[model samples]
Target: MRRKQAGIALITAVITAALVAALAAWIAWRQQLWFFQLENQLDQGQARAIAYSGVQLARFTLRDDARNNQVDHLGEPWNVPIPAIPVEQGKVGGRLLEQQGRFNLNNLISNGVASDNDIAACRRLFELAGVPPQRVDALVDWLDADGETRPGGAEDAAYLALPQPYRAANQPLTDLASLVRVQGFDAETIARLTPFVSVLPPQTPINVNFAPPEVIAAIVPELALAEAQAVVSRRAGRHFASVGEFIAALPERVRGQLRPEALTVQSRYFISEVDAQFGRVTVRYAALLERNGPDFPRLLWMRRR
Candidate 1:
């Protein structure tokens, strides 16, 4: 009878221990779940706030940087006018680069005659950069009004060999990316040269006051380093005060090529990019912007998010 009683007590004790272990495990599981939920909520909240704050910070940083120095939308500095704007997305931030500050590649072959100094520079630049003479010549032919191909430009004969059916090819370069299609240029080459070039509406001249050193070399390869340096020295404390002022700034040899009517301050496109990471997450964005600005900066266009 005593043995039977001890056996019942052992059974009861075993059952009680099982129930206690199960209960403790349930509580620990719930705690772990709640801890994860809290962490996730905090991370999302912080990410959203960081993305928006990035915009404000970009504006502040850009203005201060521009004021401190004179570089335009490109990385190079100048003595001419430049503006700043705020940009950000998903924890990343950057500034919109104003494309108007540089010479337009579209001007390379305007009309039957390449009458612009910008045209000369573009040719000279492409040549010095080791762009095949044939490709540079092809660009000139593509720029001309007539169907006749220049010495190196693509013609009807060349186009017929390709997959597309086309006639005379005289379209302006739509973007810096378009240059990659030019013969002798590959992804690597485009990456190297895109910074020194811009694609604006037809007939846009190179802004002499803000043209970079490479651009200066491209414009007039004959331009000795001293002459380009002199151009920079003269630009300080003055802006092409007017179109006429800009014309007067050029050297006598290159002076005749400046077409006053073709120059303007307005720009039709810009480029901006953003990259960000918050904790385990990362995001990147690239876009094109188109807005003219004397004061306020705003978005005119954007690419996919």
Candidate 2:
């Protein structure tokens, strides 16, 4: 009887020991997982902080540029790309681009009315991109407040008839991605036009010093693509000091087609793109900055992507 009791006690003790060992192993695993998660969170926070600092640096650069020069151009310091620099355990880099370099979509309408000159410029851009120029009429209709659709344009009725019925925005585009929603603008057209077009505040003029060759050609009627390319290439060493200078460089015949009202040598809006990596985390930051006169640039909007 004593032997049987001794055997039972031994079995219980072994089972208890096994249970304890399993519990210890599980606790250790949980602790390791928790530590890993905590480390990732810390790294992510550091990366985000670093990105924010990069944007502040870009703002400072713009402010310094404003103090030193009245003209904004590709040759200026503000347009220089920030090379990747090592941080404590990671790296950061950024670049600033003037938004005025592209054709402003909001320029299509002003003061609750359609602007003829801006429409014509946009049409030219569309034709240059090989997309139907009539697409601009659809864009104008989308931006205009009235329900009456322009020729070859879409309105509430047209959209409502679709399988996934939705109404026209009837307002200025705040985000260029919204272009895909407008009638006659598919993904392919948006992709082609993205590089030359931008959504900025109403009536913002294109800065000729930084405008792409295609945009320059669009804004200047009768200017050949090769001529536009020549104009842009010449800016590599010297930038246009004023609208008058840009017009003077053009051929005398096409010079008359250029309108000074829709062009500028300086810019008011800029984009700051910053990338930061810390440990295993990476952060992408983008912001729209507005510089008013000589004052420091103000952050219009910011996003992390």
Candidate 3:
């Protein structure tokens, strides 16, 4: 009976030992998971701080450029892309683009009236981009204060007839992406037009110094694509000093078609982008800035991803 009790004790000891070993493993696993989460949180916090630093750097660069340079152009230091700079366990990079370089979609409407000149310019842009001209009227109708639809435009009545009915905005576009909601505009068209257009404050003129060759060609009806491209190429060697100088460079036929008031060498709107990387994680920040004269630049909008 003493021997039997001794065997039972041995079995109990073995079982207890197994349970203890299992508990230790579980505790170790839980601790490891906690450490991983902590590391991730730390990396994310660092990345966010770095991204904001990049934004401040962009703001400073823009302010300095505005102070020293009378004109904003592609050749300026501000236009140069910032290469990734290594930091503690990570890196950051960014670029600044002048938003006024592109055509402003809101230019279609002025106050309460639809400007014929602006509509013509937009139609020309769409034509140059190979987007269907049929959608142009709908865009005009969407922004015009009145409900009266243009010949090819869609009003509230037309939208209501659709399977997924919605109302016409009948107001200025707050965002460029809002184009998708306009009649006859699809994802494909929006994608095609996005690179050449922006939704800036109403009445902003196009900055000829930074506009792409295609946009230049669209803006000047008489200017051929080749001629626009030539102007862009030449600007690299000698940037246009003023709108007058740019007009002088154009062919007489093209020069005659351009309205001096519709062009400018300066830009008020800009986009700043920062990409921050930490370990295996990455964060991005994009901010839109509006610089009015010598005053400090204002952040109009910001987005993070």
Candidate 4:
């Protein structure tokens, strides 16, 4: 009877030890999972904060530039790219681009009236970019207030007739990607046009001081690509101070064809592209900024990807 009791006690002890070991292993696994989740959440929040900080930095840079300089040019300090700067366990980088350097697509319409000159300029831009100019009419009709379809353009009636159809916006484009809704524009054409065109407030003029060679060529049809490139190169060393100075620098033949009012030395719109990386995660932000005067730059919009 003593031996039997001893054996039974030994068996009970072994079973209890096994149960304790299993329970401890389970608790450790749960703790590790919770820690991992907490770390991931912290990383995401940190990345987002870093991106917003980058945008604010850009805003300050633009405000400072506006206060100090009268002319916005490619050579300005705001145009300089920001190298990646390490923060507490992460890094952030960004660059500012003058939005007025590209032709504003909304310029095609003014006060409910379609401007022939603006349309022609858009056509020239499309031609220069090797995109088919056939879509120009569609864009005009899409933006114009009237429902009447222009030749080769689509209206509500035309779009509704398609297999998977929707109505035309018939208003100013809020975003550049909205161009895909207009007839004759596809993702490929938009990709080609994206670098040189912007969707800004209607009637915004293109800033000649920072305009790229392609945009300059589009604006002044008489100027050859090489000539526009030369102008850009010259301006890099000595920025154009005024529309008159820009016109004076142009060749005599091209001078007469250029429109003075369509050019500007200053810009109100800019884009700040920022990238923030934390651990294995990366966040991209595009902040649109508008500076009207010496005041701090206003955040127009922010897009994250």
**Best lDDT among the predictions, by candidate number:** 2
Query: Residues 55-91, candidate 1, lDDT per residue (tens digit)?
Result: 3443444444445544342233322222322323234
Candidate 3 RMSD to the real structure: 3.7
Clashing pairs in 4: none
Give the Cα error of residue 263 in candidate 3, in Å. 0.7
TM-scores of the models, in the given order?
A: 0.55, 0.89, 0.85, 0.85
**Candidates sorted by lDDT, best first:** 2, 4, 3, 1
**Model 2 ranges with Cα > 4 A deviation:** 1-20, 149-154, 161-164
Least accurate 10 contiguous residues by lDDT in model 4: 146-155
lDDT scores of the candidates, listed in order? 0.56, 0.88, 0.85, 0.87
By lDDT, the better pick of 1 and 4 is 4
Model 1: ten consecutive residues of lowest lDDT = 78-87
The local distance difference test score of model 3 is 0.85
Candidate 2: residue 110 Cα off by (Å)? 0.7
Candidate 4, residues 1-305, lDDT tens digits: the string is 99999999999999999999999999999999999889888898899899999999988888888888889887787788999999988899999988898999888888989988888888888988989887888888888875464433446777888899777777899878789888888999999998999998888888988788888988886788889898888888898888888888788888888778888999999988999999867899898898987898899889884
Ranking by TM-score: 2, 4, 3, 1
Cα lDDT tens digits for candidate 3, 1-305? 99999999999999999999999999999999999999899898899889888888887778777788778888888888899999889999999988887989888899979988888888878888889767788888888876475333446778888899877887888777789899888899999998889998888988888888878988898677789999998888988889998988888877788878889998888988999988767899888888877777888887784
Q: How many clashing pairs in candidate 3?
A: 0
Highest TM-score: which candidate?
2
Those runs of model 4 whose alpha carbons end farther than 4 Å from true positions after fitting are 1-35, 149-154
